[model samples]
Target chain A: MRDFRHDHSALALNTATLGHNVEGAGAGWSPERVIDACAERGIGGIVFWRRELAGRAAAIGDHARRSGVEVIGLCRTPFLVGPLAERDATAIADDFRRAIDLAAEVGAPVLTIVTGGVAAGTKGMGESLKIVAERVAQAVPWAREAGVKLALEPLHPVYGGNRSCLVTTREALDLCDGIDDEALGVAIDIYHVWWDGDLSRQISRAGRRILGFHLCDWLAETTDVLLDRGMMGDGVADIRAIRAAVEAAGYQSFCEVEIFSANTWWKRDPADVLDVMVERFRTVC
Target chain B: MRDFRHDHSALALNTATLGHNVEGAGAGWSPERVIDACAERGIGGIVFWRRELAGRAAAIGDHARRSGVEVIGLCRTPFLVGPLAERDATAIADDFRRAIDLAAEVGAPVLTIVTGGVAAGTKGMGESLKIVAERVAQAVPWAREAGVKLALEPLHPVYGGNRSCLVTTREALDLCDGIDDEALGVAIDIYHVWWDGDLSRQISRAGRRILGFHLCDWLAETTDVLLDRGMMGDGVADIRAIRAAVEAAGYQSFCEVEIFSANTWWKRDPADVLDVMVERFRTVC
Candidate 1:
């Protein structure tokens, strides 16, 4: 495994972590500025949600090429299983295609896929998984052609119904297996999978198929599922242990930092956030 | 399984659910009164925590007996793998023994165990689980002799560090398997295990060994881990689906209601809390 102890040249910052930082003051900064900030700090890469890069797609790509900042992976794009109008499905698919195009332009290695949550006003887990499976099968070929492997990210179960139906590493791998796509795998995030009973087994199963690695700590008493993410060493997650397990499973990849703390890290200065992240990355992660 | 549509006589109030109602100005009712209230309502049983009964232990048994309140199970007792001084370990053991004795007095069928989180300053997952296993093994005999089956409730990963090291149903069951005691099993609380991706498989494995069933909805936007639990139908949990799965696995037991919402539910009247609980239980669980 690549040593993270030396430098953060392999570290990728998910822009959402700093979307609300002081650097991104008015209506939050653009993706171009997000890349610039990472470059300023000698950070190596950026993993961002393509949807967030809407009007500035070309700008982001151009800046990354000029600045030598490797865009690690696009945060996500996926089909949420539900009864939507045909027009809406077409629009979503087009959006995903555009995201794939953007990732290729920026030299990103992968496009994260988080199969959307249960359909509206529904509670059936089996039905949701089936819907997700069908949608993912349809998208695999397109992703492969774009040269961007789809990184399926299973969210935590607290988000089982509303956020993402794909909620396990094994489940994501199951999708990969069903679709039979070399272009599809999983983005293993410790914050989401650390609590899983089958974590060690699943990490080993993921092996070379772990397309991405996201890091963030889960607070002992989590206040909000969407926003209360703690800094690396602030919470109780045994991150290093999980990282070791992931490494042992043959995932030699960037340790992407993805924190969504609207109340804590979001309000801090972006420079401070990056500084502390680097310090913790060296000592804790 | 058992029909809950008719009445909650087959259901048990876990007290923590009633915690929200038992707080505030006119809500300083003791745990003894909580039992009386359950009995008055013809509630089938109560699964209580020793802390709730600590102050009233002197008279709790007599009160429960007179009121015909069945103590279904004692909620918890476990010193997670913390580095307790010799005195601390003794005190913890003594406290649990007392809890088991009180549970025996009240005819509680089980004493729930909650091992402490990882020892202060320690960081690995293996060491964490090892500590919980050692602590739980030591308490098995006392719990067995007290006629109280020790039910280990694996808390969610959110509490992996400070509250309990056992963070999955499988982990708890593995501990039970290690102890190999008829007196040891697991307390399956939906709040904690509902988010588990392998929930169905684990619940199936738990089968007849599931000593208790605790229910509460997981709000899509949970604000606190210690509290902020929603009423059965007020949140996103597939309560009926989980209940169906558990029942199918041969757990013919009371569906204990256990919400800990200090903000919303706790501020309401006890009567209102009970009324909403009854309605939700009928429709949701």
Candidate 2:
């Protein structure tokens, strides 16, 4: 297990934790301001959401690098196949390609993919998953050429209906297997998978295919499944244990903190939230 | 597969669907009243919660039988293991025994078990699951003598922290395997297992060990993960497909409708709720 206590360089801020895209929530920190704040705290990296990028991916990427911080990853391509997805297949393909291009422009090594939930008119997950795989396969060559990895993030089962039908690490690994592309892998978020009994085995199964590791806590009495994510040490998730598993599986990279707290943390100052994340990252996670 | 439209005898009402135990919620319909109403509608069976039984298990069981309605099952035993469990193992064993006695007294063949979530002072699910299995093993003899099957109900992964550590049908079946007792089985609830990619395989694995089949829908935009469960056809779940899987696995039993809707159904009249359940049970499920 790596000691996160003394070394804060491995800590990465997932901008969503600072309330990026949520409507009317968050501190509303600009990209440049967020970069400077992270750099000031010796934070190692930053994961930016597309909405926050605002056509400034190249400039933001350069600014972070200049400030001695790395652009760790990007937060999500749009829904590839759900109710919110673009109905036309070509549009979906084009949208994903643009996301890949954006990641390359920002120099982000990984682009997180939240494949949307049950497709329109589809009754089950089977068909939606197949569509996700077919779309990913179509986008793999472009991703590889861009020198970026596509990280499929299997959300918690609660999001299976409309957010991301990909709900298990094993399912993500299976998708990776079928695609058989080095450009594709999985992003393991403790909030999504800590409840799984097979988590340890599946983490081991992911091995080198594990592209990104996300950090957050699962409150025992979560009021809202989507936006009530707890900060590390505030909830019941075994963060150190999961980190141990991920590291053992050869995942040596930034530990991204991606919390979506609509009620609590989002209401706090971004600076205070970042400071708490740093402390929690050291002592708890 | 069985035509629920013309024949509602296969339709069973889990009183929770009519808003029975939620705090300050649901129309507080008495057990007798619920039984009489189910009987009038030609509803096949009714599953009661322990709280609603009010020490009238024997009388209520007799009442349901006389009314030509089966007491299909009991709602749940107190959590066997986890932070919510009584620390003293013997107390857990005793409580479980009492619950088994109640199930037997009520003439219910199965007692649903929601093994509690993360254990006190424990970090991961492994230890908690072991504790659950050990406690269940200790109570098996009592259940067997009472002729009450202990049906482990795997809650949704969202509840894995404090509600139930047993969050998958496969895990429940695995627990049953370790106990190796015919008296121990699984209650397959569509809401909990629908998100699982391996649900079909796990359902088949359960086969004869499936003691009950619970019906409910997973709403697309779920507002409350615990309390906002949709009535049969109102949500996007492929209820018929799940029923087909359960029936294919040799579970020839009532399709129990167990929903926990705090905002919608619970606010309606119990009779109206029953009417909608029958209509949707026929058309949707």
Candidate 3:
């Protein structure tokens, strides 16, 4: 078990958290700037995002090594269901291969994956799940050979149809078992699973299979499904209790802050955002 | 099995769909106006909201009967657990009693009950479920004695923490069985259960225990958990298919249109709302 309380050295900036509060040119700060900023902050770990990894891989890897920042995990290879599955298979495979190479180069341990949602042109959600499971099983060998763990992240049921096929921790574990390899595991995001009826049991079941842990609060009145994430200590989730449960489950990974807030946080100052994240990480998270 | 293809006579208008659109309003449209609108349109059934019944139950009942409108179902009795449970018990019982009286007066057959979210002041979600089960069990005898069936409506998992203790069809049916009363059953709302992986099997399991069927589409990109509901054909949900599934489960009831659209439907002319609803009820729902 790792002691994260000692310093920000154990903390991983998901980049999305910084992106949540700071807009640069496109949406928020560019991925390159996000990486540079984290490096400057003496942040311990950086979880690179797939969409932002293409042009800045070498720069990020070199900077992280020079500055002693560990790239802990990659943001994602989206789940293997829906339109993205068949229509963009080759493209997905290429991106994933690149993601694996980048992770290996940057010393990131895992590539976080959200199993894709129902096929855009279909009416069956269960059918989508089956397709996703099958595709994941097929993708396991490449991941294992690359020496990068494939961390399946189960999103909330609210996103059941359009975002991700996997909606429960137990279900993610079940899929991991089907993959039947060391490379396949889970990225446990508290925002997505805090309300689960089987949460405590599932967290315990996750054990060492929890490859990563993401933190964010679920507000009492959520306005947007994708962007209205609350910061830690801002919502109803018992963060300390959840963290204790995760620790008890044998997961000693970096606590990655991932908040997607279009309205509230995005308008704040970047320095203010990092300061608050550090403060919250120390006390609340 | 009532054919709504030719007219809106088989459709019941859940008053919340129209009346409770704008939050924090002193009062929008009167219950009498809602009743008159439904009656003039020859709508077969009008689902009465409890909020409307609080002060003017007799007047609404008389108006409905005089206008030859059938009250198909009572809107709700909200229940959760712990402090809310104790606080809501008297209020719920009083509300249920009043709802039953209103139903009797207007010839309504069922009263919808929403088992609330995890207890606020005490107990976890699981414990809250137990409290809700016990509370509903205690309320069942009164419901049976009053000859008004109590229909438990399971909300979506998004409302897992703060809105409803029950969030699945199987869970609601289990609660019904736990209560052990013929008067207790479930109201199957497509908006809440369409994304459920076990939806078809659970709806089949519901059988004749399905007391009512409510229709609303879940938008692909929902902005709000409570009010961003889509009109029948505009969203991702297969409303007609779910309706068919419920009907196959032996739910011989009016197909109720219940939407809470803050941005779209509320801003439209009320008549336009009904016009679209009736057209969709004919072609889509």
Task: List lDDT for all candidates, in order.
Answer: 0.76, 0.90, 0.75
Q: How many clashes in each candidate? A: 6, 0, 5
The 10 consecutive residues of candidate 3 chain A with the worst lDDT sum are: A18-27
Off by over 4 Å in 2: A22-26, B22-27
DockQ of candidate 3 relative to the true structure: 0.33
Error of 1 at A75 (Å): 2.1
List model 3 lDDT by residue over A1-285, tens digit each.
Answer: 344464766677887776633446224666556666677776777787766666667677677767767788887775566644546766666666766777776667798887777777666466777777776777778778878898889998788766786788878888777767888888888788876666778889878888998888877566677888888877756676777888899877688888888777766776677777877887766
For each candidate, what TM-score against the reference? 0.90, 0.96, 0.82
- Over the stretch A1-285, how does candidate 2's per-residue lDDT look in tens digits? 888889989999999998887766555668989999999999999999887787889999999999999998987788999887888999989989999999999989999999998987777798899999999999999999999999999999999889999999999999999999999999999999988878889999999999899999998878888789999987878888899999999999899999999889998888999999999999998
The fraction of correct interface contacts reproduced by each prediction comes to: 0.27, 0.70, 0.23
Span of 10 residues, lowest total lDDT, candidate 1 chain B: B78-87
Ranking by lDDT: 2, 1, 3
Question: After aligning candidate 1 to the native by TM-score, how far in Å is the CA of B57 from where it should be?
Answer: 3.2
lDDT of 2 by residue, B30-81 (tens): 7899999999999999999888877789999999999999998997888887
lDDT for model 1, please: 0.76
Q: Please report how far candidate 1 places residue B232 from its true position, in Å.
A: 2.2
At residue B195, give the lDDT of candidate 3. Answer: 76
